[model samples]
Target: MGEHRDDLPLVLLIHGFPEYWWAWRNQIQTIADAGYEVAAIDQRGIAGSDKTPNSSDALTLAQDISAIARSLGASRIVVVGHGRGGQLAWAAPALAPGMVEGVLTFSAPHARAIQRPGTHLTLRTWRHVLTTFVPPLARRGLTDPVSLEHLLAEWSAPGNDGASSQAQIYAAAMRLPEAAGISLDQLRWSYTAVQRPTGRRYFELTKNAIEVPVWSVRGQLDPLLPERAWRQDHTFTTGNFRQITVANSGHFIPEEVPEESSQIILEFLHHVAHQA
Candidate 1:
């Protein structure tokens, strides 16, 4: 967490699955030192946030971000997210136009890009996605520190010595009452949303090009998302957009390469500030 100043731009950091506000521990101070206010939040139903059953749909989650921004007294904010959180960041401008000044996403592509014809999910990614639908299996996996550690090691770039410790922390968080269930619910909704009317409306609303500036970053070694998932994302943005690949990194770019991530974020913040 950083000081909130009305004059300074608010950078809202939203974490992906199996992570809470602590996910941004590496970037928070760096951003604050650069003269920006930062707020890394634990999305609803995870960590300290309330567990509102069945409210993990895209529309609801986006609304939560908007509400948090407003509550923080921010007229506009730069949203930074990873994985599923990145998907929500992509949706923010469309769901709450004028509320988001810019977006910086890590390891996640635009929703349309993911749904585009011929796009495919890697087997590793599919395994995690499928686990969400199986409650017992999902819970078991999340609650076991060893399983989480294995996942982190698999998903992260080689030689990430901190992955095991991070997994232990995440495993402990997941053991909180109902936290595992909520996390699974969020993933489950992502997979089955297409069959629901609300999900259809959500996609429709975001069908148009994003008018705000966007920066998409991914680790070069990330196996979860292929290049095809985000290579053509420029077509979905009518405003300024850029794609960056961090060499030797993996799915968890923020933690895998904090210095580089911080540098990229600072550059984006400078761009957004000058653009405004």
Candidate 2:
């Protein structure tokens, strides 16, 4: 593959579930302005990218990353992922160590095993449950206009901000019930495969000690990922990691606080590159 340009280092920004490349609208422009070659693609079944018939298990998603990077002519890259994409960020490096140069994740645990210590983690497990159980019901409900709006509102961040339009476009792309949320078929297949023993093995590989430098960012007020809960989790490597807590943001860090989010990423990249 041919490089886009020699002056700019390639950075592959991967999006989380319920999102496509549009999720990183704020970060993409900022990174590009800073003179980096940035390419943010829709993950499978998300947007302009191909929605393959196979399961969207963690390994399949990670392999997609390798293909995306190589297709963009990136010999190695500074990879960034958020939320569910953060899970991919952790997994991709361990699964294909030689291809990734640096890693950054936001608002979610890296490939570490799910450690449910108390009611909170157990309650948070609803994400998996809902995705598994409600997709069919959701598909049916989405057939209604009112239900479709509700689904879009739920999948999207609920606030009028700079990123709100981007969120709307993303929500419109779901199109399962004609621009609602994920289809029952997508949900059923993904959940079935991800819950398997082999799926657990792939996640284990992602959590395996990533020798490359890593950064984790979270917001103090994020509802989905509470600061206290994340602080108590010990799955990631502490010695080689850095954590930044934004004062009053939420799980959707990129949208909640774009400037701060972008700044933290820029700083981490500079520090890691200098150390290298």
lDDT, model 1, position 61? 90
- Over 4 Å off, model 1: 1-5, 117-119
**Residues forming the 10-long window of minimal summed lDDT in candidate 1:** 1-10
Instruction: Give the TM-scores of the predictions, in the order they appear.
Output: 0.95, 0.81
lDDT of 1 by residue, 115-207 (tens): 665745678888888777879988988889999887887888887744556888898899988888888888887777778787888899888
Residues 1-276 of candidate 2 have per-residue lDDT tens digits of: 233346434788887655677878888777776667888877676655666654355677778887888887777777788877776777777766677777888876654433344444434445644745765565445445455444434433445243444544654566642223333444443345446765766755655577677888876655555555566434465436777777766566787678888898778667666656
Q: In model 1, which residue pairs have backbone atoms overlapping below 3 Å? A: none
Residue 80 lDDT (model 1): 98
- Candidate 2: give the clashing pairs: 175-179
Model 2: how far is 73 from its true place, Å?
A: 0.9
Give the worst 10-residue stretch by lDDT in candidate 2: 176-185
Looking at candidate 2, what is the lDDT of residue 199?
71
